[model samples]
Target: MNMSVPFSLLFTLIILFLSVLISSTSAKKPGDASQDLVRSSCVHASYPNICLRSLSSYSGPANTPGEVAQAAVKVSLSRARKASNYLANLRSQSKREQGAFHDCVEQMGDSVDELSKTLSELKHLRSGSFRWQMSNAETWVSAALTNEDTCLDGFKEVTGKVRSDVKRKVTNLARVTSNALYLINRLDQSRQKTP
Candidate 1:
């Protein structure tokens, strides 16, 4: 009789433990799961905080490394577009620094195009074509980042309100583009190490 009581108590405890475990695991929201993925993937990035900040705003959960890379590219595209528009507006307003503003506008336009190409390549990345697609995307994003730097370089001699304005926008875009590149490189490395 005593053994039967102990067995029943032990079974009850086991059942309780399993219930708690199941509830805890199931209680995690999709957002929480994706956030975990984001954090883990960002650990591989050069600028982890920027990567997380830029990608965490994506509406759906980025469940895979590819999804995270896609999100990063999208964020880069959006930032590049904004920078292009800002430079275009600055070019229109420029009276004294026409040459510098024009050059910056052209460089930013190129940067936007490169970023768009990166996004396009990333969008088409499939399991069978991961390496080649990632390589192309990386090249495009790197070129975009270079263009942003070149835009700032064009303003080295020009010191005025125009330089300051262009500098601010270009710097912001460059940082975001750099973050995207880091994430892409991370994704590539991670995939290579898998299987």
Candidate 2:
């Protein structure tokens, strides 16, 4: 009897549980969405211009933190799993897609720092006792704090000791890749129409 199937199922269940926990922690509390907590939202979406750059441009020395790209995004699934486990043990924050996000944040170093700081500030605003009461506020705060630390820590771990900007460029590339794919699909459809 091969146990791989059952083991695979078990592993999946564990990841799902972790994912649920992380998502629950990240959900916008009643306090988060209200006027009391409202903050600006910006265009963080991946743009197509970055995608057009050659892979050579994106590649950088793994140890050197350079502008645009400083670290290599060579993370594997197993490494991602380890990162998620580390984050899950942090006891305060929840990282949705903890595994995947670890990689993303590593690739988004400076961007991650800025994003974390912004999120941390938003968290502080909501946790203020003056805001309308929301259940799990304490849990939420703990999670936010944990996430802030985790973002910094994860950035370090995945960047292979490179600067934060390297991570940011990696994250930016992901968005650009998505945008490129979308454009390619659109072009393909248009070409089909020409026939």
TM-score of 2: 0.22
Candidate closest to the true structure, highest TM-score: 1
Candidate 1 lowest-lDDT run of ten: 89-98
Model 1, TM vs. native: 0.79
Report the C-alpha lDDT of model 2 over 1-195, residue by residue, as the tens digit. 854668788999999999999999987754343211111110121342333233224333221111111111121112223433443443322343355355434533433343333223323433244133222322332333343344545545343323354344344434433332333233233334654
**Displacement of the residue 156 alpha carbon in candidate 1, Å:** 1.6
Give the alpha-carbon lDDT of every model: 0.80, 0.35
Give Cα distance to truth, residue 80, candidate 2, Å: 16
Among residues 3 or more apart in sequence or in different chains, the pairs in candidate 1 whose N, CA or C atoms overlap within 3 Å are: none
